[model samples]
Target: DPIFLSSFWQELFTLQGVLLHKSTAYHPQTDGQTEVLNRTLETSLRCFCSDSPHTWATQLPLAEWWYNTTYHSTLKCAPFEVLYGQKPPIHLPYLAGESSNDMVDRSLEAREAVIALLKLHLTRAQQSMRDKANKHRSDRQFMEGDWVYLKL
Candidate 1:
């Protein structure tokens, strides 16, 4: 499908800041990151707008903030922090009184949080894989005399 004519497509391309492929019908995995990001965006939108579907326009900014501020397990940093060296300002009205000094502190906190989150996720994933490997090794039923057809 042509995207140049669509403002939605233009905005997507601009925001992504890179050229994206138009994947073949049965092999969408060629654009895996785009697919993953789309899913993430949709999930963020849905979760943020659950209480006000009709007013989701107002929730998009917050959703974007959350997505950009949170650390990505694979990227090793929050999207915004990776791109800008600092997380973008979150639009929370309750924190409107924050000063420039406060922002400096907040950015430091955000960086630490991102690092902690990444470490936690990495630890959990490694532990899960180790557990699965141990279980598989323990459950093996091979016998010394058994003839097994191992596929090469």
Candidate 2:
């Protein structure tokens, strides 16, 4: 059943522009950030479903919202804000008195600020990741016919 499901998913994702990479069993690094995101989502689900695990499905949207609103160490900004250029406002009865036009203007200004910050954060994160990765890597050259053991 799982094999069939996996095959179905592979087909579905490929059709949706997702790339599938074959990897050795138990190798999380092969998928890079996808593995990290899965761990984070699992942790969030566990926290949300402590009392009723069956309710996890109902809590998924809330988990997604929390994840999107939470700041990432590398990104230095909430995922939603980075993508949309502004953070979604929390419910505030007091702010209901403000005119819609004023709110729009304020949101636009905040979005511009956030976009600037996001660009800076992205650059810094990229450089840091490159430096860290290079530290663990070695420079090597291989001839066309050279045999190298590929780690599965």
- Per-model TM against the reference: 0.41, 0.42
Tens-place lDDT digits, model 1, residues 8-99? 88788879896755566656478777678768877766654554568557556656777888888888888898899886676432332354
Model 1 global lDDT (CA atoms, 0 to 1): 0.67
lDDT of model 1, residue 27: 61
Could you say which candidate leads in lDDT?
2
Q: In candidate 2, what are the lDDT values of residues 33-65, reduced to their tens digit?
A: 779887888877776565567877766776677
Instruction: Give candidate 2 regions above 4 Å deviation.
Output: 1-29, 91-152
Lowest summed lDDT over 10 consecutive residues: which window, candidate 2?
Answer: 91-100
Q: In model 2, what are the clashing residue pairs, if there are any?
A: none
